[model samples]
Target: MGKGRAPCCDKSKVKRGPWSQDEDFKLISFIHKYGHENWRSLPKQAGLLRCGKSCRLRWINYLRPDVKRGNFTAEEEETIIKLHQSFGNKWSKIASKLPGRTDNEIKNVWHTHLKKRLSSKTNLNVDEAASKGSLNEEENSQESSPNASMSFAGSNISSKDDDAQISQKTFEHILTFSDFTEMLQEVDKPELLEMTFDIDPDIWSFIDGSDSSFQQPENRALQESEEDEVDKWFKHLECELGLEENDNQQQQQQHKQGTEDENSSSLLESYELLIH
Candidate 1:
């Protein structure tokens, strides 16, 4: 309509319409024989009435041997969605991942199918904004007052506690499953248990496991320090156990008060039982 980039095709003497089957056969035969020498000059050379642009588009979009025309699969649709999410409107790049599917085909599929699917998920798309708003509110609350700072610190500690409790709950749930129970039984079976417990007896007796190796002076000092640490750990364990037993006895001695210490003692006993 607007003189159109100085007319690649001869506007005065070219034909344009739906290509005939004979026309398709001639175009295909010409391309196969001569390999489309020049698409601009192809219409005249090949004795086709269609414009070169139409010929090129037809060859590229439909008549090309490599063009794969079929129904899209579920897997292909999923791949398209993921590709689209990562690179919006990048039809050419998207087409590269999907063999035989042209950029034009990919673009059409996205417009007709994927675009509608995403349009229906507007609420899901806004969830990120909602989460961000919640985070900002938390920050503002934390910055409001001294009391708010203390409350935020308490919340941080509580969150850590919640995470630990949730992890423990999840572990318990997993342990309750039949497969996990079977796995536990397999691990606890006499042979497996013994194999796991039976470490190399001479493991700690070597410096890098070489029989004739002499330890460096620094290594000897470090080993001595570790020995002291082992002795200290044993002493600490004994002290803790003694304190726990004393606390239990005191809770029993003060049964009339029904105090927090008694509850703590009962909880510790339950923990010991569970561990065993």
Candidate 2:
């Protein structure tokens, strides 16, 4: 294991706990006047008794003027949950996607509020994976614990057939339950007839292609910025959906003239409908 960062100052000497108004003023004032490029020297230079780390946290989480102080907006919270799904426990990376929010604040919010919200939203556990004890003895044994949580990346769920198993296609990557119900409701109720796919060539390629050979629409060149996380997620979802449907069609001998089955085709339509 790597050595931890050694404390810069003696712990007993530095002040701790809630910052006084004067301390806040001093930290903010010093930062504004002479930027906090070097946090180690900041406390001594600013004439504050707090440690450099404390000063940094104070400025970042509480003292920053642009810091959003009120309750998080609904959209902000939703963004956090989605980002968490994409990047587990990567608070700084997640915070980077959300402007004016510090990693510390986001971490606290997740622990205090969002964690419960997510659990309530998706009560899925790893028991489904553990039940397939034959797959990997070690993996299943570890997963059988009560505290075991589901990490849905490439996770599998067993089917009714004892001899045969069905691949779950990493339900997390395909359609996260957070938005799955929402998507299903839209499918069940076709209120919005107006829909279009202003899809990036990169994303549309997976959806519009025929057979195993993937084709880029219009032979369009894909730049780095052409696609994003959500786009990639949908692309994977569509590809897996097609493969799953195709497999079912083969099993049931329900092949049509087109490469994709009816269910996959209808799903593609639904996806393209809400693409915009």
Candidate 3:
């Protein structure tokens, strides 16, 4: 929050830069013995020569027992990417899903690692396609029979369709990242130091209305309102297909039941294997 009202102490008086092992031990022991009742009082109470903000950061990011250190696994990386893709610049929100990971750690990994990975993959794909040999009409005809040509044409169309869908998803992800970065800059201002996430539950329920099992009736109403807006094309298609609202409702019920059953069966089998 822009140095938190000039840090309330002289910069030279307080310890700065990376926290040392002794500082960590002192912080952890202090936290365990006295607890973090108040940040301002904590430093003096804990006998640390650091500001309250610095103490809090060191505790949360490093001293906290729950904070996972070391390298992120491939699975964790994938999870982080998917969560970021869904949540945009909500690094704290994404970090909540991943136990033991700090929001700052996740953010750094996204910026330094995941972004480079996606860029490289996109470049590699482009390079590979460019390296492929082009074919003349005669060569194309010679390489494939009429049936095969028809199949190839169909595949080409399908590939084009998938490319369009993928392009849209990629563009949305990029927009999300851009928007989040802009938001991060804005929120880092001095005025809005304290932010609330009380509306997140409401927002998430609205976005993922299809998962009715996880929502309350009040939340479901919000979900339905948003669903009405989000699935406009799907609703139009349903109407064109002459499917009534009741039919669609029944279909959703069946789909949910099938999914639940499959999940239960899978979990039960895993449990049985463990028991055996």
Estimate TM-scores for all models.
0.42, 0.43, 0.43
- Indicate whether candidate 1 or candidate 2 has the larger TM-score: 2
- By lDDT, the best candidate is 2
lDDT of 2 by residue, 99-137 (tens): 446798889889998898657545755565553343246
Q: Please, what are the lDDT tens digits per residue for candidate 3 over residues 36-123?
A: 7688878877678998889988876765534444566555666677788899989887766665567989999999998897677667
Model 2 segments more than 4 A misplaced: 1-6, 124-276
lDDT of 1 by residue, 1-276 (tens): 676577787776887877754455456545544566578888777778878998988876665544445445444565678788988898877765664457888898888987786576564676877854664575465456453311111211232355334333322212112343244345334455333322111111111122111112334444444443333322222223333344443432333233345434554343333222
- Which regions of candidate 1 are displaced past 4 Å? 1-5, 123-276
Pick out the ten consecutive residues of candidate 2 with the lowest summed lDDT. 207-216
Q: Lowest summed-lDDT stretch of 10 residues in model 3?
A: 149-158
lDDT scores in order: 0.49, 0.50, 0.49
